[model samples]
Target: MSSPEKDEIVVQGIAASQGIAYGQIFLFVRSEVEIPTYQVDPAKRIDEVARFDRALVMTRQQIARIKAEVEKNIGPEEAAIFDAHLMVLEDQALIGETIRAFESTGNNIETCFNLVSQRYIKAFSEIDDEYLRERAGDLRDVTQRVLQNLLGQTENALNRLADQRIVVSHEISPSDSATLDRSATLAIVTDSGSKTSHAVIVARSMKVPAVVGVRNLTQRVKSGDWAIVDGYDGIVILNPTESTLFRYGKVQERKKSFESRLLEANREPAITKDGVSVTLMANIEKADEVGIVKNFFAQGVGLFRTEFLFMNAARMPSEQEQFVAYKSAAAALAPQPVIIRTLDIGGDKPLSLQADLFPKEDNPFMGFRAIRFCLEHQDIFKDQLRAILMASAHGKVRIMYPMISGSEEMARANAVLAECMTELKQRGQPFDENIEVGAMIEIPSAAATIDLLAPDCAFFSIGTNDLIQYLLAIDRVNDRIAHLYEPTHPAVLRTLQHIVEEAHKHGIPVSVCGEMAGDPVFSPLLLGLGVDALSMSPAWIPSVKYLVRAMTMAEARALAAEALTLGSPKEIYARCDAFYRARVKMD
Candidate 1:
């Protein structure tokens, strides 16, 4: 049953990420093949084993074909996620588990795969964290696809699907997304994801329309179906007719045109029409992302998360290797300030060196983590400082200490910095003595005591994600409290404005390196609040630049003043919304 000529069959959910896009619904259909539990002759075990191997080989080939076909039609960038999916197929974890279970239980591949998947799924289900719990989807996706290959039933519509604008799956496993006609598939949607999730990373790189965390998309959409995806707002509509498509399609085109116009704006200073020059920086986790700065033509790197280098590595990267990575990245993007935050791992990612850090804590979020761990474990702290010092010679590097609470913490940390510098100098290593140091205002205490800590640091980068979490005492990753994670919350805004104001009073440059900086909804408020710079992912550069170049400081400030008076988060957002709607020129 299709909707009327002008009507759209829209699917609604909590909009995770924001953007508008039009695409065909590329349903990522998956079926988990069960391991047969039928008793087989002990003598025929060899035959059964051979059968399983053949099935595995054939499935691999099918998946490979699907990947190749989709990539060829859609474009490699659009479909490259399947490569990650392909890796999962070969993962020893899933395949090995199935084999082990089959060997031990004397069950066929179907029963073994089910047994293994269910066990891992159960374990994942018990986890309280949404990020960890949702990992079950990936586990299930990978195990099922690989099992299907083993069962020789890999042929599916997604294998050779073709489209211009595609409505991607709830979560397009890297391998599954690879097979597509990108021109045909214009947008992507997923049921489960965070901004940092791999699928979104790939989508941003491809520069397509995407709405993540759209639940049950695969089940909601069908083959050869048309859908409207508000990639900017996380809205998906099934069976949107031509007229409905045209209305949104025009908006999509205008958004594209507006982003193109901002390419020049990136090169132009972020100074608003009223002469308020806000520093526009980029947030990056990988070395390759340095290119984003140049591509978006951003001013500098606001938040260079060094944890990625440390967390995903097999072992500690040698000092020389760290120097090379940092040097190459710095030299490549010379002149642009890069604020590297020391490893802020513990709750989301744990270090093997500090296994006992969280001792039976009820809330790891509030546990002995972040800077607390660094203070206790001076050895680890020293190594990271040494690495940063060694790399500073490459270019202008700013050090932003994470989780700092007060002046004493900064003093104690700086004292250790003095010691590390002494050791490095005695060892004949050259370092930057003039390299500026900054502090991440993530915790509420750090913000409250900004006057105490700001004196010691060269700069301040407010990490709003954590600040809001701590101030409200709500865990954003927990579904129950996740909705409360509002950047527009008056308390959150007040804290953000306070940090910027305090930093400016001390003559130190202040920037926002949090996710809020990237959001279009809150970007105006930040500028109005007197943010010196805003750093976010590079993909947001164009959309963000459009708003930045169009507004005057007077207008932004006026909007902010009214926004502050609102009681509800929704009300604050509405005032800001009304202001932008009336002011933003529709080209």
Candidate 2:
């Protein structure tokens, strides 16, 4: 089928996964499922409940099998999305509500499940935050699985894409995206999705070009029509002219050359021209991402966010499961250190276990979260600690606690770790007796009281992402005030300087593992601040390394000192921008 008009048309969206591609549009129109509602016989209520249970079981098994496949083919990080899906399927709130609906209205099990899932999907879709909004896709993904089981539907249309084509859809769920033939699919264009959506996560993992949140995209393009997907800029050109295609072809070649250079710089040391060596590490959300760290030649896994294990699972992960995950990563980065952070959930990433464990708070970001939650629930806390300690013997694994506010919390947390160590010893289980422990100095209170907290800790990791927001008294997720969330703010710089000074004074190293750490523009300022290490996304390591290799420690220190003297963010940005421009040129 051909498009009505051939004039060049462009649609913009969030640039989810980076790449460039040209292909014929393969419109994936989702025909609405005709769901019928009716009252069931009172005598058959038991059977109704059993039917729902069986369908739920089938859905869970299907997702779990997919999780295993994804873990084997892609990595554990990508497979973690299915864990979240399983949690959604097993959500008590959702299940309870559906059961109540079935009991009250005697409606078909499929109808009740659909109604409850729609309510959740609608609620998540209306959220202002991008992360929460993207969860709507997750709810829908799980809901569809249950519905498919109830209806006995087999396979997604995505599985039928036998030829290479640009996929255009209303929205691609994580499950649907997981079944996609990445080698055959040229690119992805969706009318709805967030940057943090599971679809985007899978696309990034598969290295497929994707453009999401394009309104009415499915309606704009038809099957067999020529299209161009500029994933780098989040633009989709439908019914593209030959000239436009020619231009993008050249652009693709240039991008390939630039990326090749970045990859080539991977094996080189991240050292300054003056011979000052800096540790460049990767901040991974899961153990599977350790492979990327190796690919990028990162010094180590700086921050292994263990929260994914808890947040993604249907229930709390057992000690043995957590042990295997931690061990896998520790073994992957053997000899080099892998700092495994304990579970840090309850704020934006809520636990899936019970309602009382994670209550809805108006300001959850600053509410009872992180170390506070773990401390209150020691059973959960101890399980994680035991797992970390058990995994330590696999390699150079260190333990780090998140959201440390003062010395008291550090002491209490350490006491718990010690208790776990003692128990492991009593059982004659092997573990690293000399495992190092550290604190994540993200809170303003923690930074201010670093002197007291530093002595008890082995190292400090500066979480500038939270530190900046809290220091500036702004919520970065709040778009109206997001502009105020400045990393180069004067107060932010001062706080970082103090944390580094206190940590160094105590003879401990400090690393920046936030968005700023990955930013090439802020590399000199952070280095000058006396930061001992830098940890960021694996993809940014080489570029940041290139920048590190080009400058002398003296130049970086001079730039940092001048930045400290600046009074405003604008001025600080100017200094860093001028220095970065003078030192490095874009390819």
Leading candidate by lDDT: 2
Instruction: Give each prediction's root-mean-square deviation over alpha carbons.
Output: 5.0, 4.0
Worst 10 residues of 1 by lDDT: 347-356
Candidate 2, residues 1-587, lDDT tens digits: the string is: 22446777988887888899887888887655567888999999999999999989999999998899888888887887887787887777778888999999999999999998897676556543355568778888888888888888874758678699888899888888888877788888898876777878888888889999798878766788888899878999887777787888888887778677767776788888999999999988778878789988999988988876765455668999999999999998999999988887765556545545777778777877789999999999999999999988999999999988889999999999889999999999999998999999889999999889976788999888888888888987675897788899989998989989978888999999888999889978999999999998888898788888889999999999999998999999999988887876534
Query: Compared with the true structure, what per-residue lDDT tens digits does model 1 show for residues 313-422?
Result: 43555666666777777777888788888767665445422334545455666666667778887887888888888888888887888888888989988888889899
Displacement of the residue 109 alpha carbon in candidate 1, Å? 11
Q: Which stretches of candidate 1 lie over 4 Å from their true place?
A: 1-7, 13-26, 33-157, 162-165, 183-186, 204-208, 217-221, 241-243, 351-360
* Clash counts for all predictions: 38, 0
Error of 2 at 554 (Å): 3.0
Top candidate (TM-score): 2
Compute the lDDT of residue 397 as modeled in candidate 1.
84
The TM-score obtained by model 1 is: 0.81
